[model samples]
Target: MTEEIEQFETVLGFQIPEPLRTVHNVHRWTRLGNSDEESIRSIIARYIEYRRAIGTDDLDLLRTFRNNGNVECIIQYLRQSIRPMVVNTLDNSVVLICQPGGTDFHALASLFTSRQLIMFYAMLGEYFFQQVITQEEISGRESGVTIVYDLENFKITDYLNPYSPIMQIFRIGIALLQEYYLELLRNLLVINSGPIVRVFLQLAKVILLPKAFEKIRIISSSNMKERLLELVSSAALPSAYGGCWTEVDVENVNPLTCCTIRRPIEGKAPPCNIEAAEHVNLSAGKSYSAKISATKGQTLRWIVKTSGKTEFAVTLYDSKGKGEAELLIPRLTIATPLPDKVPEVGSVECKDTGVYGLEFRNVNSSFFSLKIRYGWVLE
Candidate 1:
């Protein structure tokens, strides 16, 4: 395999980096069944060019984003703007599970440009490659990753139309994975597929390479557990999918958490002591507000869990003492906390010196008062 890689490099007149030098990595090209050396060389060249084009070739910058709070605001923004997707790495496989039906696709489209989304994905890809693929290679195991897409309730309408903004984002994500990270994928398993999912797969066929499309399997919900157990261990699989592990178990094993670094402390002694959780009882149709003064570049971080659905918003008052207000976070209904689930975590860097107001409105029509336990820190 090494000799073949050397021969390919000599013919192509380019050095293949250490990251792509493994036997399994090189074999991934042949898996495409394009036996022609010139065609394979062109594909490899294109892959390398795409990586450089996205600035993912700079490992240090990617690492900075992974371990620092510099991009914490953007990370939180992306999470709140879109449907949450969980990236779980178990052994040689990475499972990507999408939350069921919470995201507003149109709102997400208007929130960010295609370039911003691609850059975010680039960071995630680099992290997965360094943490998952590199570790596997060092252990003398095959370097390829088996990718599983758990699309139980994923809506096809948001992604099927080519003209839709969500579809545009979908294409960008798929193109990035196919063009730059194709070699890392061993096989793609898509569980909990229905008739609508089959229709979506037909669209996927048009976008994916023929060889790559052939590697996808659509498993029904009935046999999903049995089929997944063949690829993932019960210890690694989520309990929702007939496995023994809980959501917390899955979170603990994820490698991407390192990318969402917590707020840093300056000295051994705490900069500001942790505040006690403030309890608020909001009556129906009433709103609660908490104001804090902040300067530019400071981050406002909060953790809140609500007893019922509530609308939360953040406003920035101008430093000039004018009554003008800028809605930092528009009023949006927050999901009620589930048993043992993590609280809603959010953070945004202050762009101007102002008195920031955090408001919570009881959006529910029910007569019962909404209970909220929340805490905030400006760092």
Candidate 2:
């Protein structure tokens, strides 16, 4: 309210519309992650510049949202269930939600228009900036948000045709965030999928933008929850989805404040760590390799204990070039005997000694930790 346009005059090095001053809470909450007055002003200026480039004027949205305040039904949607839960991690908080089965998108869109949708995102942006981003910034690291969409019972609907109005509205909402908000979304996780998920993805591939499409992870139901556990702790997830949150969550109970995330669990059992080896985090779509010099025929023995159904390949090569060396062990995706047990081990002799290359690659899109140990011995 303190002459926001004037404050941003020099920060943005451009002229801002005077009508933007009438927007409610427009100036406030802009500095959720910023500490000083200049910092917040700079953030607003950058946002305005980006929006202008993307052909989305926030002034129009703010002007439209100022008139509608009857959000009783929208409030119900926010608190209908323990949804859109924030899972606090080392990097930042991930907004996780279990999509309601058999959704009524049409009725909801009718109740909430584009104006209301704009206000909704504004509120969410403020909350995320204040609660998650600011905290990470204070700790000397840039913050980001990961959104998880649990597609457990998603139904293939005619309402979700390629060019439907509902999908258009959804795309608009996504576009608003992508264009206006910078460096906000870290990743989008889609799990607990079924047959309908394939159809949805097929359609989405054609409609979605390249950046948004790249962020999507269509995980298998077998290892879906396990993949989510890596991004968000098990304590942050619902008990029904291998987390610690119980049926009755009291007012004081919050994953960020009260929930202590220790490890992943299934039903009433402990985590999947069969062999007590050293745990190492595996990055998705990246290959991890280690070189060990082998003299004559030193046997290379290794054992890997994974957390869940993580597809990984173990390859041992004597050299690294077109002329392939003796394949000590061909790359094979390690399979878990059962969903509960995840322990795999293999040993291959190094036929020759010139810098033997041992590579371990994560074949999945989601991150999974591995408890691995290896050694070289005389055979």
Candidate 3:
């Protein structure tokens, strides 16, 4: 192996992808979040989070994925699968809709390995995030990404088998979309939701997040098109549903093999820390707060802004309310670029494992409403 590859394995505890062997290639993928060197413990914590998000307890499989630990195979089918992906013309959200009867489930499953399916998770993972978040007219008023699972002709055998690849892929997709891809998933709209889909979703609530599923829209097949058009544009739906793109054959895996078939919902959410969000409005001299509790080596990240006026300064405070914060950030006075209520965002590593407070101070004399979203790294 090359020295650079060896370095990647040693430092990140994984090999660099074949494409990212050179310094230039490393910098390319590194541009996202673009952090400096981190501790091994930090890397371990992140990997653990990924594993939980994908509903996988297989430590070895988690460690030895496609190219290495971080990067996975950049398969063409992933990008080519236009059936599930559509950009919302209204909110500009990425709509990953599942078309029932559109793709052959069994054949689709036969196309890729269980590893690659998860790699599809890793490859396209965080892939659309930067593009999704940055196109902000105003940072605070960001658009949302949505997943529309259209189970129009889905039968019980489709997802009943717990071991099916579709179920496996579904598990990974739902968990990761819920856990790692926080705040971005504005809604998980389920169109063409018949009794089965409804019951499936209800059962899924146990294995998945009740809150995330709360964002689901279980509409009838007849109303699916009209309802979706209200939120998304015709562009986001399949041509059969009045969009430009043609609906492809439903290609997925339906594992006929199964155990006791009486189960309603199949799996459960992976055990891990969750990202949180809340909406806040403040008046002049008033303040709002969101806090992240981090250990000695963990990191705390926060983003906040007011809708009416961007007159806000978000500061960090240690558990002790006595003085200024101990951690460091790039900016103290996070400003919204003129005309845009762009949020002031920053991340600071904790010096100690204590509950830290994030105070969104509204120095403005007038009242303003703001949304505060935050989370911290923990294992």
- Report residue 273 deviation for candidate 3 (angstroms): 39
| lDDT for position 198 in model 1 | 66
Residues 7-55, model 2: lDDT tens digits: 6555546555543342222333243324465666665665554334323
lDDT of 3 by residue, 233-324 (tens): 77666555555544433232111210011212222222223343556666666666556656778766544433332322223465466765
RMSD values for the candidates in order, in angstroms, are 16.3, 23.2, 18.2
For model 1, residues 1-379, the per-residue Cα lDDT tens digits are: 6798887677767888767676666666665425676767777776665555444565654246534333343354322111122223345554443332334554444444333444566555655555445555656665554555655556766666775654655565566666656666656778766767768688879888776788787777778888777776665456666555443332223232111212222222112233437889998999988898998999998766677666676778765567676666534455422312335556678998879988899975678799887778999
Each candidate's number of clashing pairs is 0, 0, 14
Best TM-score among the predictions, by candidate number = 1
Which wins on lDDT, candidate 1 or candidate 3?
1
Question: Which candidate achieves the best lDDT against the true structure?
Answer: 1
Task: Give each model's whole-structure lDDT.
Answer: 0.59, 0.48, 0.47
TM-score of each: 0.55, 0.46, 0.42
Q: Clashing residue pairs in candidate 1, if any?
A: none
Off by over 4 Å in 3: 1-89, 100-112, 137-140, 163-169, 243-379
